[model samples]
Target: MDLVNHLEGRLLFAVPKKGRLNATALNLLEGADIQFRRENRLDIALVKNLPIALVFLPAADIPTFVGEGQCDLGITGFDQVAEHDARRRAIARDQAESGKSTPVEGAPAKGCEQVLDLDFGACKLQVQVPVKGKYRTPADLIGKNIGTSFVSLAAEYFAKLEAEADAANGEAPGAKPLRTKIIELSGSVEAACALGVADGIVDLVESGETMKAAGLEAIDTVISTKAILIKSKNPSNKTLVDLIASRIQGVISAQQYVLCQYNVERKNLDAVCKVTPGRRAATINALEEEGWVAVSSMVEKKRIATVMDELSKLGAEDILVVGILNTPKPDELSEELLNANTMSSPQPSPPTQRRSSSPPQQQEKESSLSRLVIAPLTFISFLLSLFLVDTYTTSSRRRDRGPRSRGSWLSALLWRQKPGSPY
Candidate 1:
């Protein structure tokens, strides 16, 4: 069977095959209710319940796959995306300088856009040096070798530093500009400095335990990054892409928030609202007991305990916090269901209509009626204006006329237009 033909008309989603982000990405998809089963030794997995195919690739390569339009959406780290973007920009610059329209071999045609932050696999890319080494700052590593997996990002950082150093020197005669060499290391970047392969290293630090275990200390942080959802700049199926994004956003929201419910006195309802304002507005319901109300709201999980305490102080009773397993955004699930129903239902063709000449004849008559009405109204309006001007000029010439006499002409015109007056 041809898997390529099988995947036609389906969204290609790229995910990390194996790495820190791989497990978390899969868990997020499960939370979003995207069911899929990957067979052993296979790179692609078809979603069981949706028109989506998951393509397993390295986290570092996911960005390139999405950017090149080979995949519609992907999950990767922000650090990888930044590195890929930097490489793309460098390639574009080189192409422009060389006056070539063709892209460099292995270069992505375009860059991907970040859709959502997955809020996992949190880490930072930092410049690490020997714990007891003299390198204390990023500047201290000038003219030193820096090893990193992110070659483009590391080179870009050092280029900025070199530019700054040159500017500070102010073109001093015979002064040599300091340049940092960026060495690309695919794995075990922490051992680069200890192995004498590089003076310092730039690498991802989650808890700093690994760096410390390897006898290294972070001198400066380059960028903080975490797992992120990215999409192609131009998607093949925009509706499906948006649907997936909405589902993931809902899952993240569900994880972050808890539903809080309580009963309170009507008089204290105002104060309770101020505490648990919910996402949009608090749900208020009249209780069976007079002067009492039940309120339900969504509150951040981290602050649920504090919120309960505040509600208790405000005379709230029967307070309960409920965990949400899944919560899609408003109208998102309904819209998808509606689209599915529409596709599954058979559409009937409309009855054919015979060509008719009545429309042109009706339009001509309407135009003629408009011309007739407008011509008479315009003529009457012109006559009325002439009479008013003649009356005003004649009144102004009469010096003996009093102010009341000057106003008489206007008043007479108004009186003629009264309900029972004749023209």
Candidate 2:
């Protein structure tokens, strides 16, 4: 079993425990071949192969866990990281004013920073109203209560809206005090207004299906968000953190495409190659036919059919699209790995910046737990396939004795397998 030793200071990666975030995160991790097997009711999963521990938790809590250094790294939504930053800034200021250190360990020794945009769990935090609300622009929400889970972000957006509204009235922007009240809600933020709790809402819009079903429409977007990899304001485990991040980038690249190769006439090569400009195509001489060349290139699956049709139109014959299980070049994975690790040394902490945010581990021995399980199960399956092949080949074959008393090849082989008796 491939496993990692339970060292006291091993890296902990916090990810969403459930919901859309959980599935996407798992898929991304698996694509990287990080090797993990999940079990029911387990919050922590130790990677069988790497010195890493994964802690599953609510998506909203990832920032908190990593911010306080309970985790060395976290995968969370950009919105949550922004929210945490706003809150942390506020708390850090309070800590500085009192001449006491923040209780939150790992609270970016500097300040909050967003590391990687994971490109999953995409959604928009938007301001929405009933489908036909007369309030069309930012000015319409003046003095209205806006329901939102992201009070900090919503407040910031509305404040900007108030300035714009003021400017439209021939007043200087930022000259008027914003009258919009941001009502924070834990859930069902959209229903709040339809249920008469607020005039508008700022909440995540995924596919716009739910909002449309609820008889609401997005009017203005506060921010679009996706999962992001975050680290301590000043991370301690820069090398390990970078390694995981690069693996993530590699996995993403791997899922994207395959290389294709085929032979075509030289006269039609230009037309065919034009259809795949973004691809790094190569040409080689064809031995089978005069004035023919073999072409190989990378093409996205989604674009292959269209490009193939275009190639056909251009007179390229004998076209073939081969599936690629892997590609070694342009090494996106290798680049990510190198970049993540060889960056700068730790910098000194930035000056304390404070505002307002009010909110709320253990060096366990490096558990020799494998980050992955069931790998042996795969090897077993391979062995079984091998044995089946051998058995099938042996059973299906027959030995022949020509120009002599007929004897099957199998009979001869079996005779060889027998003890001292000769046939």
Candidate 1 per-residue C-alpha lDDT over 180-273 given as tens digits, one digit per residue, 9 for 90 to 100: 8888999999999999999999999999999999999988888999999999987889999999999898788778877777788899999999
RMSD of each: 26.4, 18.4
Off by over 4 Å in 1: 101-109, 172-178, 330-423
User: Per-prediction TM-score, please?
Assistant: 0.75, 0.67
lDDT of 2 at 176: 44
- Cα lDDT tens digits for candidate 2, 1-423: 222344356688888998778888888787656676666777777877777788888888888888776778888899888877767765665588778964676543643457677778898888898886767775688789888888878777877777776777788544344489888899878789788899888889889999998889887887789988888755667897878877776555445554545556777777767775433444444433346665656567778888788777776655655543333233433222222222223421212222111111111122222224456667889998887677545544532322323345543554354365332
Quality of model 1 by C-alpha lDDT: 0.82
Error of 2 at 76 (Å): 2.0
- Candidate 2 has what TM-score? 0.67
Clashing pairs in 1: none
Runs off by more than 4 Å, candidate 2: 1-7, 88-108, 111-115, 132-134, 168-178, 267-271, 277-290, 323-423
